[model samples]
Target chain A: MHDLDVLGVIFILGLTCYAMRAGGYVLAASMRDDGIAARFLRLAPGNLFIAFIVGGCLSGGLAGLVGTMVALVTMAVTAREWVALSAGFGAAIATSAIAP
Target chain B: MTAAGFRRGLVAALPFLLSNGAAGLVMGLTYKGLGLGASHAILFSLLVYSATAQAITLSMWASPLPVAAMVVACIATNSRYLLMGAHLRQLFGGLAPRKILLSLFLLADASWLMTSSDADRNGPDAGYLLGSSIPMAIGWVGGTALAYAAPLATNGPLKLAAALLPTMFIATLLPSQWKNAASPWPWLISAVVALLVSHFVDPSWSMLIGGGCGTLVSMMERTDA
Candidate 1:
């Protein structure tokens, strides 16, 4: 087992994550039931999705990200989730491991 | 709803299973790479499943950076939780506090989207979210085990597998939002903001800002309309 501070560490680590999720929660609450913010909150998934992809693929750099994109394109065409995920993650692990 | 609701939840979670599993698997392998065990990786995923956050936290292992700094950084990065928890109130509006907290842990981009879409389509997916996320929790553990045991750091095919998270998310989320939109504004706005983030922000910090920007844009448009 890890030290007693692992969760503490994770909590600190995950705080930013909690903040983002919480952003939705807090903002959603401050708005009226049928208000504009409420509608915007409802539409958030699309924006968040694009942001997540950009962060994951591009932040990692071009080679793996590009390869990952090819894989995503394949998955989109096929509509096969497992296939694309495998290609993206597999490419990352392999490239990182072999980088010299 | 019927038992088919559970089935539908399963189908909706399929992409998450792959992405989360791959991510959990990668974290496990990273744990091993840093001389930690697969168990460490599994435990982390079981407890905290956020991929970007996990990657940031785990990178602490590869550096001389203070572990304490890593912890603080992760918290800063993940501070968006207030939003996720708050939004969930809409879905689980009248639920007990315990259920709220329980759902809070399972809630993320995938779970939120699945739940929201299900609710929009079926109106309140209290039972469905639980059905969907429990399986996802299991998948994370199992996949973490695979990555830990195999540790596919150099494995080309496996890396490709892990790359699917963002794409899968995009595939499902885009259609759901735009399928109901009356104009091209939302899609166009989302693309421009996402592209700007990709160009300007660190990939790590961009998700939060991009999400925030999108919400802000949508809020203004909705107000003016």
Candidate 2:
């Protein structure tokens, strides 16, 4: 592909992504705040987050599982994100080293 | 746009400088391996600005570059943003549209999650949203450029650890998302469904399908209550 073609593809993909990012917000302007749709929006974030973690763990395998557990426990006990992330990183490395 | 809020958000997001940079480095290497020029690689990161979307595009990359398929895959992988944007509208609906839309350009998963948590505690501040988003963008774009300028030979374990950063970041935020007794059931449902979906279908769709199912269960439980 020519440089111009690559640039075009990137530009189009970028626009597509931005459209998705903005589409819901624009569409939600018509939704009544008290409606079921609004309620679903309110309730979706946590579940979405949990699903993300599960998907991540599944892809990462035992190392990912152990790392996430360590991170969750560290977050619970210390309530510090940096600390938990650090602990999780270390645990993943250790687990990866030991798993195979 | 409050200066104080922006500063707090910027400081809070400093940790991602490392996490995002590491991941971005890996992405940078991948692009380089694909034979993309430094400028093209950096532009891809800046424009697409999504690890998932970019990864998907890279998988489908070819001489002709299937433009239609790439666009479809990008939308599918990033459909979560639609839900996130709707939620943000609920939080900052009254804000000026121009400001919100401009800020949306820098929107990212980590920044959105952090901003939502911040809003729950400090109320909606678009400044903070923008501030938090800037570092993540920098880490990603800058890291991609750096990788092209200076390719780093990464080992297996180190790369694995870097890859886990986003997951770890999400895990840390899990505590704040815990609402009450009702939270567990939905969360468990989301996890199990996500695992099942990832196994059977595409892993990419797992989050949306699992999360959507879990949210439906929560809504039903709420109606019953």
TM-score leader: 2
RMSD of each: 6.8, 5.7
lDDT of 1 by residue, A36-62 (tens): 544554555555555555655554565
Q: Work out the TM-score per prediction.
A: 0.57, 0.65
Candidate 1 on B11-89: residue-level lDDT in tens?
A: 7787667766765665565555555555556667766666545654553343233555454445543444444566567
Candidate 1 stretches with Cα past 4 Å from truth are: A1-7, A15-27, A31-82, A85-100, B1-23, B59-87, B96-98, B149-225
RMSD of 2: 5.7
Q: Point to the candidate with the largest lDDT.
A: 2
lDDT per residue for candidate 2 within B1-225, as digits (tens), equals: 788889989999997888788667767876766678889989999888988677657655777877876776577557668777877888888876666887788789888999999999998887898899989999999888888778464457656655665577668767765652265788899889988887776555666688778878988875422
TM-score of chain B of each: 0.61, 0.70
Q: How much is the lDDT of residue A80 in candidate 1?
A: 58
The collision pairs in model 2 are none
Docking class of 1: acceptable
